[model samples]
Target: MTRLLIGALTAACLVPAGAAAAPAAADLEITIRNVLPGQGELRIALFDTANGFPDEPASTQPTLRQRADGETVRVRFPGLPQGRWAVMVLQDLNGNGRIDSNLLGMPREPYGASNNRLPALSPPRFEEALVTLGPQGAQIQIDLKQP
Candidate 1:
């Protein structure tokens, strides 16, 4: 028993410092409101960085995507590490799997960002819509802007 105890302790100490277990992942719940009467599904995206943030309404790539339709939509992102995250929502009014935009590059369909922030003449940046997820996770609400 004494030898077994010492061996166990030695093995524990031999573990590299960098090999420590990762932090527990948390869940993120997003509630989107102000969904206008439309004919297509909603495309919601979750982004962890500024790159491709509020990506072109037609962009096919996003960290995460969910299709929903309603005056209020709720989606869950489970097992996400506690940190900053940004969300962008597009009301795909044409069911084309993307948001339509006018010639001036303004979205023709309703859209929104995390924190309910929208910048005029341009898309909202990641930092502009950042939300912090604590160890216990977080919940946020966004309101869409109509064209």
Candidate 2:
């Protein structure tokens, strides 16, 4: 397989993922785990850095608000163009716009990214998180915080 850099994100030239020579467009179901209990709301954004950070809409946004307590949440993005994309997740501890962080440079509020990539300890490389989307759809998991 050949890897092409379309910006910060890399696109993999996927061969027919089976008997199919190519895949038609499909949806992406993202599962988020380890959410803080009683977390008020979560905001997830989709973008294609290949197009210079052009934004792609998630099925919802500051969407997927949680009312009670839970460790995991699921969100879906439908009709994602078959290409390279990047994701940003914000945990609105108080349903606020800005994210809160500690003096140690650690997030005090809920926040995450594709592959659960962190700032320092386990920052994800482009190749490590870049994924191929197909007609059958795919699921990517992101851990909520730096546990």
Best by lDDT: 1
> In terms of TM-score, which candidate is strongest?
1
| Candidate 1 accuracy as TM-score | 0.87
Tally clashes: model 2: 0
Using all chains and alpha carbons, the TM-scores for the candidates as numbered come to: 0.87, 0.62
lDDT of 2 by residue, 12-86 (tens): 334334656555677888888778767567777665543322122434322334442567888888877777656
18, model 1: CA deviation in Å? 5.9
Candidate 2 residues lying further than 4 Å off, grouped into runs, are 1-23, 50-69, 103-105, 121-128
